[model samples]
Target: MKINFKNYIASIFITVLMVSIFSSCTETKEEVTLLFVGSFTDKKTGEGIHVYEFDTETGKSTLKHTIDSITNTSFQRLSPNGEYLYSVVDSQKKYNGKVAAFKVDVPNKKIDLLNIQDCGGLNPAHLAIDSSGNYLVNSNYSDGSLSLFKINNDGSLSENSQVLQFKDSSIIKSRQRASHMHSANFSPDNNYVFAHDLGADKIRGFELVKKQGKVSLENPKEIKTKPGSGPRHFAFHPNGRFGYLVNELSGKIDAYTYSNGNLGFIEDYLTYQQKQHIYRTADIHISPDGKFLYASNRGPEEDTIVIFSVDENSGKLQLVGHQSTYGEHPRNFGIDPSGNFLLVANMYTNTIVVFKRDIVSGKLTKLPFDISVKNPSSIQMKTY
Candidate 1:
């Protein structure tokens, strides 16, 4: 065979060029992180859900798309795999709330609604999907119920299979006179689900039992919070050894040591410095590294996010610092997957503020640019 050395050399060069191009493309895709914000919708200035492209390098976010038809999307979450999105229609009317699922396409900036289902209770405030993405737990605020739904293969939600209603009340007459479940969170192991009840002042736990393809919550346990603490949101440390609950009415955070399916109380810390007539501590989240915990406190007095350094070995917290949200009503906030930024959804101010986070100090500094979205209610971020 006659060898063509020139042709062979050219072919090798082309092969190397193709390999470099493919590697670049893959890195670009992996670097993308999307910010999904759910907002309260009204007839006039309604933006139901907005998605943004978060630039990890610059710490800036640009609005990518908006879905305006879904009304009152107060809370939204992405599936464990980042292939689906779920949001809640936070209704005030009785039995009129819903949970909707969508197929998320980040590169194309599209979110197609898969299906909507009745929440089986009033005012679906929060929803969380299990690690397997096979089960969804929705907490209804007005009626104080937790509804369980199974996720279909295509990411749509099945009708709620079970609804657990709570009729207990707490010491506060006006706020705790009736049951008001605020949020539902899954355990780090996905073997249990916990619901925070604001009105009843209790953290309710249920063993998640999955048989074949169906799922149910069994072995319900009620752990009483402070009499008037009004537990609203719960977050577990990444180590799975500790958990924290933000008390809405009393402006306190309860720390607990978690083991198996039980929570042993550690202590409680005040979320704010001064006492006030009303305290609306809203959201709680731990850093990806589990070194710090951030909790939001809404205004009647001050709008701030309190930062605490975690004692990794002891599962205790030391107050690190506080950052003003730079807007009113810091209802919910999210820390990026890289732990480099924190975004706050100030519902009353109708803006989303991005803050550069100091991983060492667990402090937040306001970024120069912020997003304007009407009634921004919830903040969720996913890396795709």
Candidate 2:
């Protein structure tokens, strides 16, 4: 046998080359940049919706741009893929009340209007994408109705195949006068849509039915809260076993068990208490890690955030601690994709306050970062 050192060196180089090529091909892609969106429509000035951009790393956000012609851009939603952004406005159109879509330019960090769709009802406040992303769920606040629309690839919204109006009185009439769908959020599976109706005083659940390129709602169910609770914003547990709903009028959080997108009995419903004064709750979110739940309390002039520990097994909540947001009226906030920071949207005070999470206890300490905007209502992030 002739031993050739030169050939051995060449073989080693070829093997190294192949390994490098395979590694490069198999490397996972970096997460997309996170885009923060907030809508603002000034009442007195007849202004339009304001959109902003934020650097997820540094907790820095700037007013990237604005989209005009929106009378009241109250809530905005990002497509499941993060390619398109949708909003609800106060429209006086012929048939459709008010809903519009915008193409999200992920690279330039800009937004452009796509098309407006008739909401079929008035005061459209919440929009969500079906699990298949083939349909858009619209929650009309004033009419207490929910609409489902077929979404096109270009980000345009078509008419919904079905619409449901809820008119139930759940143990409370003063608060549940008629019916008011305050917010709508989807479960992890996207098969179920939960609409939080303040006036109706119930969390309405609708099942998503898919056929080819179209989608509709089915398998309706209702979860009633305490009389006068006024459920507004809702969130689900990470493991899909629990759900949390924030009560607007009573300043309480209702924790429940969810199976197949339907909510069961309330395991533990507690109110946010700061010292002796009871605080009214605004927005609530569960930590991405599924260990903690953070709820925002706006006390007219004073505001604070309460944190709770989630029992991984029973899906119960244990009060952790409360922290001040250093702002007023925190209507909405977004937990960063990394779960390291939370940016609170203070509407009355006009600023997005940032906070760092204590990993062990889930308590939030205000960070020295604040993104300013005019009348920021909803905040969302897109990691592209």
Candidate 3:
């Protein structure tokens, strides 16, 4: 064969170029972030859990998958390792609520149902998983109770290991006719479990104990909120020294000093600008960096997210500003893992709005794009 040096060189260069191009394509395909939206399923509107691909660099999202048949998944929590997901099926009937477990397939944006077990109470609204991933805790809203379930190795949930019911009620007649347990969460140390009762106006703490390889709750303690403050959701600072509780009816955030499973009142801060306006507070979350805090408000005329700056030493909050959600009934909102974006679910308007977060100032600027979903009540994000 005749030697052709020029053709041989050209062939080598083309091969190298093709290899580089293929490598770049693979890198781009693996960089996607996943977002999960939990919603109330309606026959006319969309139902089940909706999944989306979020672009952290561009601040945009696209719907990827929908897991249907599960109704009223108003809240969900991703396991610490991101391999599993747990959700509460909010039901109105007594003892009809359920807690379900799902195996997460992050790369494919899919979730497989592992198993579901009865929540042992009514209107289960919130769920929390311990740091060890060995237990799942549920808050029963209407029945004013909390249930703890053991998590199996296969991502399934076992029957209730312990159930605690509250019977005390506060002075508010209509709203406090019975105790309404709204949220249950494990303390940052995992040494204690906290449950917030809206109708009782109390934030209760229980010691987490292990006996013979089984976990249980003991040493119950209660902290009273302001008389009319319906304490609903709770958030602990990243530092674990300070805690925040959002009052559902009073539109206030109560600051507390948390230590050794005990919560001491620090101060009460209003989430809205005007005291006269009717305000219904929904959720509270601390930024991953612990420099800022955000709370959601819902009312006929007030649909806003209140932003506050944290005083590191004192753990007190300073009013930063408020951003209107632009949609009705801002039920819940969350700060992304990177602490770069904030997402709000407006249930009444059926929309999820994204905002660019100012990490330094703790202010939010609404993004140009928003997602339309059917009654999107909760939003959770996990990056794989």
- Model 2, 229: alpha-carbon shift in Å? 1.2
TM-score, cand. 3 vs. native: 0.91
Which stretches of model 1 miss by more than 4 angstroms? 1-30, 43-45
Q: Residue-pair clashes per candidate, as listed?
A: 0, 5, 0
For model 1, what is the alpha-carbon lDDT of residue 268? 91
**Ten residues in a row with the worst lDDT in model 2?**
270-279
TM-score order, best first, reads 1, 3, 2
Q: What is the lDDT of residue 299 in candidate 2?
A: 73
Model 2 reaches what TM-score against the true structure? 0.85
lDDT of model 3, residue 367: 94
Off by over 4 Å in 2: 1-32, 44-53, 91-96, 170-174, 211-214, 274-279
Candidate 2 per-residue C-alpha lDDT over 1-384 given as tens digits, one digit per residue, 9 for 90 to 100: 998999999999999999999999999976545545555665322445555565666666676666655676767778878888887777322234567888888666777888887787877777877656677888887777888788887888876667788776555555567898878877877778888989877888877777786567778887778878888888888898888889987778888888877687665455556332444688888888999999888876458788899998888888887778788888788787778888888888887788888778898877776876777778777777
RMSD of 3: 4.0
Cα-based lDDT at residue 66, candidate 2: 65
- Per-residue lDDT, model 3, residue 225, is 90
Error of 1 at 185 (Å): 1.5
Error of 3 at 22 (Å): 17
- Candidate 3: stretches off by over 4 Å: 1-29, 42-46
